[model samples]
Target: MTPHDYLNIGAAVWLFVCWVGYARFARKRARTDHCLASVLHVYRKTWMIEMLSRQNRIADTALIASLERNVSFLASTSILIIAGFVTIMASIDKVYITITALPFANESMSPRQLQLKIVLLLMIYVYAFFTLTWAMRQYGFCSILLGAAPAHDADIGEAERRRYAISTAKIIDQAGHSYNYGLRAYYFSLAILPWFFNTWFFIVAVGVVVGVLYRREFHSTTLRALVRDLTATEAMKKSPNG
Candidate 1:
C-alpha cells in the first residue's frame, strides 16, 4: 500500500462519517428547529389535519399512493444499478482498461484498487436500495393508517383526532426521511466515481458532494420559502379572527 492507497481509505471513511453524522444531526434538529425536514414535518401535520376535516378522502388516498409509487420506482432503479455494478465487477479487465485510458485517470491503479472502487459503488447502491425499500414499506404503513383514520364525522373527540393526525404525520415524515437518505446515498455515490481516477480527486469530489448537500439542506432558497410560509401560517393563527 502507498500514500494514495491510505488516502483512498481515509476518503471513504470520511464520506461514510459525513453521511451518518449529518443524518443523525439533522434528525435531532428537525425535531425542534426549522430546517427543511422540520418544515416538511409541519406540512405533513397540516396535511393530516386537513385530511381529517375533509368529507371525502379520495384526494388523500391518491396523494399517499403517488408518494408510494415514487419510492417504489427509486427502489427498483437502485436494484438495477446494483446489478450493473455487479456486472462491472465481473468484467473488471475491460473496465480497468477503459478507466486507465481516460485522460486524467491515474494509470497506476492496481486490480485491488479498482475492485475497491467498484465495491464502494456497489455498497452505496445497496444502502440506497435498503433505504428506498424501507421507505416504500413505511409509505404502505401510512396508507394503512390513512385507511383507518377517523372520518370527518366520526364520533372521536377533538383530542383523539389530533393525536391520530400527529401519529399518522410522524409515520409519513419517517417515510420521507428514509427516501431522503436513499437520495443522499445516490448523491454521494457520484464521489465514488472519481476514486477510479485518483485518491486526491476522490477526496475533492467527496467535499464537493458534501458542500452541495449542505447548501441544499440548510441554506437553499427552498428552505427560506418554507420557513417564510410557516411563519405566515403561525402569524395567521395568532390573529384575532384566525
Candidate 2:
C-alpha cells in the first residue's frame, strides 16, 4: 500500500481505538458510586450557605482543587488533539487518499476538485490552529489564577480574601469553559475535514469517538463524573439570568 493509504488506515484505526477507550471508561464510571459526584453538587444557594457557615476554607479549597483538575484535563486533551491535527495535516501533504478508500472521493476529478480539496484543507488547518491557540490561552489563565492564590490565609471575610476567591473561581471556570469549547471546535474539524477526501464516513467515526469520550466523562460514576458536573455548574453560573 502507498504511504497515503497507510495514513488513512492509521487514522481510521486510531480513531476507532479512541472511541473504544472512551466507551469503556464511560461504562465503567456509570457503574460505580463515588465522591466525584460532589463536583456536580453545586447550587448557588449551597455556595452561599457555605459562605455563611464560615466554612470558607473548605469551600475555597474545593473550588481551587476543582479548577486545577479541570485545567489539567484540558491541557492534556489539547495536546492529544493538536497531535491528531498535526498528523492529519501531514498526511494531507504526503499521502493521497484513494477513491476506493473513500467511495465519494473522485480520483480522476478535474482541476476544480483539486482546488476545492486545497481550500477545504486550508480551512481545516486554520480552524484547528485557532482552537489549539485558545486552549493554550486558557492554560495561561489557569496558571495566573494558581499564582494569585494567597500565600498564607486561613480565614474568610477579609475583603481581599472573599474578592479573590470569587474572582479566581469565576476566571478559572471561564477558562475551563473556553478550553472545552475550543476542544469541541477541534473535534468538529475532525468530523468536517475528511469530507474533502470524500471519506465522510470518517465523520461518523469521529462522532462515535466523541460520544464515547463524553459518556466516559459525564456518565462516569467517579471523580470524572464530578469533574463534568462541576464544569457544568460553573458554566451555569457564568450564564446570564434567563
The best candidate in terms of lDDT: 1
Worst 10-residue lDDT window for candidate 2 reads: 36-45
**Runs with alpha carbons beyond 4 Å of true place in candidate 2:** 1-111, 154-160, 193-224, 227-242
In model 1, the worst 10-residue window by lDDT is 25-34
lDDT per residue as tens, model 2, 172-194: 44554445544554564556455
Cα error, residue 65 of model 2, in Å, equals 14
lDDT of the candidates, in the order given: 0.89, 0.52
Quick one: best TM-score, which candidate? 1
Q: Write the per-residue lDDT of candidate 1 for residues 1-242, one digit (tens) a residue.
A: 78877777788898888878877877786677678888898899999998999999999999999999999998999999999989989999998888899898887788778998889889889989999999999999999999998889999899999999999999999999899999999889988888777778878887888788878887899999989988999999999999
Each model's total of backbone clashes: 0, 3
lDDT for 100 in candidate 1 is: 90
